[model samples]
Target: METININLTNGYSIKSLCADDFNIVKELCEKCSDYYLLIEGVLPSKKDVDEIFIDLPPNKSYEDKYVLGIFKYDELAGIVDIVRDFPDAGEWMLGLMLIKIDERGNGLGRNVHRALSEWASNLGAKSFRIGVVIDNHKAMKFWSNLGYKKIKEVDMEFTAKKHTVNVMRLQLDE
Candidate 1:
C-alpha cells in the first residue's frame, strides 16, 4: 500500500511506518502511554508496548486484518488497526488507533482516518466499528464530527488497570 507523506507545521512528515521503525514506534507508544491510560483506563507497561511491536501484524496481509502507521519525519507518530467482523456479523472493527499528543491537532487524525477508511472500502468493508470511552469527550466529539455515531455501549474490563470502560461503536457506511 502506497501512502503519501505530508509535512506538518512542526516539519514532521506523516508517512507509512515500515518494519525497521520499531524504535520510533516504541517512542511514540511510550510518550502516548499516559494519554491512553486516561482515555482507555489502561496503563500499558514498557514490556507490554515492546510486545506490541514484536507482534505487529503485517498490513494488507489478509482479507480481515490491516495495520497502518503514521510517521513524523523518521519517527512514528500514530497507528491504526482494523479487523473484519466474524462471519455473519456484518461489520469491520476499528481495533486500535493512537496519535502522539504533539501531533494531535494538525489534521493528522483525520488523514489517518481517511486513509484507513479508504483501505477498508477497497477491502470490501461496508462499515467500520470502534469503541470509545464515554468519558473521553474530546474523542467522542472527534469521532462524531467524522460521521461516526454511537450505535451501542458495553462495559469492558481492563486487566492491567482493573477499570470498566464504556465501549462505543461507529458505523462507517452512510
Candidate 2:
C-alpha cells in the first residue's frame, strides 16, 4: 500500500522508506547503538537493516508492511516499521520505532506515533500493538505514557538473543 507523508508540529515529516533508503536506515540504526546493545547485546548488523524491509509475520504479505522514515528537512531523524492486519484483522503491529539518539526526549516519538496512528486508523485499523523488551525501562515507560496497556508477556528470540517482551495494546477509539 502507498503510504502518505505525515507532517509533525516540530517541522519533522515522515515518509515511506524503501530499499533505496537502506544506507540511511543503517546509519540511523548505528547511531542508536544503545538500543541494539541493550536488546540484542551487540551492535546492529547488515541483516538487521535488511530485515526492516522484508520481515513479515506468518501469512502476511510484503504489501502489508510499511517501513517509514522520519525526517527533519533533508535528514533522517528516525524510522518506523509497521505491519497491517497482523495477528488479526483490524489490528496493526508496530515492529519498530526508533528516533535518532540525538532527537530523543523532545516529544518527537509521541508525535511520530500520533501521526502513524492516524494514518493506520484511516486504513481500517481498530487497534495497535507493540512489543517492548521487559528490561527496556525507557521504552516501557514511553509506551505506557502513550496509553498502551500490557496485554501479556511472551518470550521471544531476536537476533540470537532471547528476551521476555511485554506485549502492549492500544485500542483506537474512533
Candidate 3:
C-alpha cells in the first residue's frame, strides 16, 4: 500500500493510517460513536477500524482504498475513508468521514473536505459520491453546503439497522 501525505491550508495534514496507528484511530472513532449511534443505532468500536486496516473492501483487489488519519499539528483530529472507481467509473467514494467531537462546528470539517476534494481531483477523479443516512439532517445540510446534491436514496443495512441512505453526488471542477 502506498502512503499518502497531504498538507492542508493550515497545519493540518492527512496521512496514511496503518495498523500501528490503531490507538489513535480507535480514539477518533470513539469520538464519532455518538453520531453514528444517532443514525445507525450502534456504537462504533475499535474492531471496525481494525477491519479496515486488516482487510480490504469487497470487489477491490488492490490497495485503492485509503483509510486516512486527519491530523492537526500532530494531534489526530479525525478519520476518513476514500475509494477510487467505486460503483461507477471515474467516481470517488467518500466512504467515511468523522471529525472529533470538540472539533465540530469550528470550520474544521470544511477544511478536511476541501483538502480531500483537492486530493481526489489531483488523482483524476471526475466526481465524488457519499452516502448519508436519510434522517441525518445536520449531515445532509453539511454536505449540501459543500456542493454535493442528493441524487438518490437507497436502502443500506448499517450496524443492524436498515437505513434509507441518500446518495449524494458532487461534480468536481474540471
Candidate 4:
C-alpha cells in the first residue's frame, strides 16, 4: 500500500507507520494508556507492546492492517491502527488509538477521529467499530462524543488478563 498522510488542523499529521517506528509508537501507547499497564500488573516492555500489535485480534488481519503514526514537528505524537472489512460487511475496526501524554483534552482526538471516519467512508465502509475499556471514563466520553454508541459489553482477554470491553460503533452510512 502507498503511504498516506493526513494533515490535522492542529499541525499534526498521520502517516503510515513503518517497522522502525515501533519503539516510539510503543512509548506513545504506554504513556497514553498507562492505566492498562497498571491493571495488567506489569511495567512497560518492548515485548509486551510488540506482542499486542504483532498478534492483534483476528479482525485486525495482516493484509488489511493500516498502522499510522501521528507526527508533529517530526516527532511521534500518536498512533492509529485500522483493519478494513473486519467482523462484518462494510465495516472496519478502529483497532488502536493513542495520543501523546501531553496532548490530551485539546480536540486532537476529534480531528483524528473525523479524518479516519471520512477516510473509511470514502473507502466504502459503512461503519466503524471501536473497543473501549469500559471503565476508562475519558476514552468512553471521547468515543461517545464522536457519535459511537455502545452496542455490547464484551469480555476480552489481553496480555493474559480479562476485562470488560465496551464494543461501540459509529455509523458512516448516512
Best candidate (score: TM-score): 2
Q: What would the TM-scores of all predictions be?
A: 0.72, 0.97, 0.91, 0.89
Considering every candidate listed, which one attains the maximal lDDT?
Answer: 2
- TM accuracy, model 1: 0.72
lDDT of 2 by residue, 1-174 (tens): 786688887679999989999999999999999999989889999999999889899999988999999999979999999999988999999999998888999999998989888888989999999999999999999999999999999998876589999999999874
Compared with the true structure, the alpha-carbon lDDT of candidate 4 equals 0.79
Model 1 CA RMSD to the hidden true structure, in angstroms: 4.4
Worst 10 residues of 3 by lDDT: 53-62
lDDT of 1 by residue, 1-174 (tens): 454454545544445555576666677777888766775456656565554434433442344554457766666778766556532255677666888888898787887777666655665677777777766677778888888877667766554443334344555566
How many steric overlaps does candidate 1 have?
A: 1
Q: Distance from true position, residue 50, model 3, in Å?
A: 2.4
**Model 3 accuracy (lDDT, Cα):** 0.83
lDDT of 4 by residue, 25-47 (tens): 77776786675563454665677
CA-only RMSD, every prediction: 4.4, 1.0, 1.7, 2.0
6 in model 2: Cα distance from truth in Å?
1.2
Q: What is the lDDT of residue 76 in candidate 4?
A: 85
Winner on TM-score between 3 and 4 is 3
Q: Is candidate 3 or candidate 4 better by lDDT?
A: 3
